[model samples]
Target: MSFIIDDTDIPEDDVILFSILYSCVTVVFAMAVLSKFLTNEFRFGFRSALSLAVLFLGEPLCQFFVKGPIGVVCFAVGCLLVYSILPASHLPVGNKAVLITGCDSGFGNALVAKLDSIGMQVFAGCLDKDGPGAVSLRHSCSDRVHLLQLDVTKDEDIQAAVSIVQAHVGSEGLWGLVSNAGVCYIGELEMISEWITRKVMDINLFGAIKVTKSFLPLMRPAKGRIIIVSSVLGRISFEGYGIYGISKHGLIAYADTLRQEMRKWDIKVSLIEPTGYATENTSDSSMRLKREEIWDTMDEQTKATYGREYLDEIYNNLLGIFKMLPDDLTPVIRAMRSGLLSKRPRERYPCGAGADFVTYIFGLLPIWISDKVTMSMSAMPKTAKPRIQMIQ
Candidate 1:
């Protein structure tokens, strides 16, 4: 068949197809960024739906009035171009080697799965050798998941991890480190033993430092990312979380300073502050056990002084609040992946609904007001003054 050049044969269907494809691509890009920033699924879903509805209704109207598909294409291209130029946390890299601590459960476990789904070679460090999380990760990811027994608080464990990575580097190398191992201690700071306080700091803050220091050499001049999994409590303190909050607060400072220190070597340091996650880490069983242990250890005199009823009420309320909070750990995994793979990763990523909201509100408040708010929220009943003995 002989084909004749015919400009009139260009169908309207082609234009429509092009417009739809362009619009969809633009929408995906927009949503990706929104997902990164907003993090709340309900809010993101609603806003996304609203925006698309407007675009669908408004685009046709514009096309009708403007008299061409050209107008729609032009507008779509313009918006897409603007989005392309805007800074986004999503990464382009694929198939990286990643190591994550505390992968026995919770956010670390979730993140390991997510990274594996994205085709990364994941090295999951768990506190338990035969834990359900380790078994699950191995089952889902098969050989792609490497399980290592690790306790971040222990120097020997840290060293062993370093050795493993070094051996792997001889063949395949790591791209990032996710410092997700940490413990929480709830109670009056004064009530907690000095040894327990030290242990909390050792695990939460020092452990991160040790792991980073040990593994950083593996990255060398090429540079790798370090993601510190902190909490919203890091930025703002709450009642009964005095020790836990203090440890995380120290982490914020540590991450910030480390970011600056690592800049010279092109190594990036990022922080993920997630709100309460629905995991055994924050479950009623764990919290109740800890509270009971603390209560049981108290001397009769100490119990009499504080009153058992008051302590019980305070601990119960704290755990209840944590249980009520919804968990969306996807944002934390997203942040971790972005930090590892993005060309320009953000210094800090706040995850979960409450965390993002609280962070924004905290930013808006004055320093004095914020301090007062924290103090008021964490207020406890005053202790009775020591009895004075009169000399006769």
Candidate 2:
């Protein structure tokens, strides 16, 4: 009648063999789970789920087979060892050339150094080749890194870049094309002028498309990789950043379609979607200035529609959020490197903390649930109560 009526009739050797068999099965499961966790952009949810699985399923299975606490410890140690030695699928980097746009600053500029350090031939496309960001890249990177004065928004620049790249690579062909050039603009949809919207779309959406298309011929010969840097907002729209999100959203659509179409040619396409980071484009001070500029430029009626206090409140809350953002661009740079060099590259790299969770919710949840979840996020429009009628 007790819980201890166990395996008294079973042979000791038989029991030991069963334990070893279960341990092997568990090791395979653990390896698969750990590999998915790392390669799938480090999803925090996956880590949580892994913990739950181990607690509920793994514990019982281990107890039934191995019959001791020591078995559990051994299992954990095995998982750790497996993760430590997980093999990365990386292509040969020697003599491979990669072209990255938006090298004037931020992720693009940082990635130039990263690729150059890895001994990959880097073609850094800067909007202003003589600017400070470009100059720093020139000084920091080795001779393998070449600087090209290229603007994504300009057809002339795109054609010139093609010619320059063709001349250098010759018959070898370009190995990678990273469409990292983009502009950030955050404003209410109504408050945003037509020109401003076009500017954002031109740089963030059309520019990326043109750059990718222009490089496809070269990429086809080498069966190169295409990595597009988008934002988490591209997947889930946020208040006060409609235009910027739209542009990114467009890139998401383009990249997804291009991936399927390029399968025949063996070209790989990937998307890097990151959350807020302390880059020049997302600097708190610069954002504040940009918000203030939008406010200053609004006409009387438009201003009346949204009071000055409303704009300030939105930006103030956002500034607080921005201040807490991680300044390190390493995770994003690593994603780009993997996208370019990995033999089996991931289709989407969601970089940043909580990014995968948020994207998962928005992508799967219902509209109402997503709205509620979005509200829970910090510095959103729902939190900012706007007064439409200004007092005299």
Over the stretch 212-257, how does candidate 1's per-residue lDDT look in tens digits? Answer: 8888877653477889989899988775688899999999999999
Evaluated at residue 268, the lDDT of candidate 2 is: 92
- TM of each candidate vs. truth: 0.75, 0.83
User: What lDDT, from 0 to 1, does candidate 2 have?
Assistant: 0.81
Alpha-carbon RMSD, each predicted model:
8.4, 5.2
The residue ranges of model 2 lying beyond 4 angstroms of the native Cα positions read 1-10, 20-88, 376-392
Give each model's whole-structure lDDT: 0.73, 0.81
RMSD from true fold, candidate 1: 8.4
Please give, for residues 1-392, the per-residue lDDT of candidate 2 as tens digits: 55432676457886676567556657676667566567643434455465446645764555565554455565566455544433246777978999999999899999999899889999999999999999998888899998999999999999999999999998889999999998886767888777778888999999998888888899888888999999998999776778888999899999999999999999999999999898888787788778877887777788887788877877787888878889999889988988998766889888888776778877888888787766577364665555577556
Pairs with backbone N, CA or C atoms under 3 Å apart (clashes), candidate 1: none
Separately for all candidates shown, the number of backbone clashes (residues 3 or more apart, or on different chains) is 0, 0
The TM-score between candidate 1 and the true structure equals 0.75
- Of candidate 2, the 10-residue stretch with the lowest lDDT total is 79-88
Cα shift from native, residue 186, model 2 (Å): 1.4
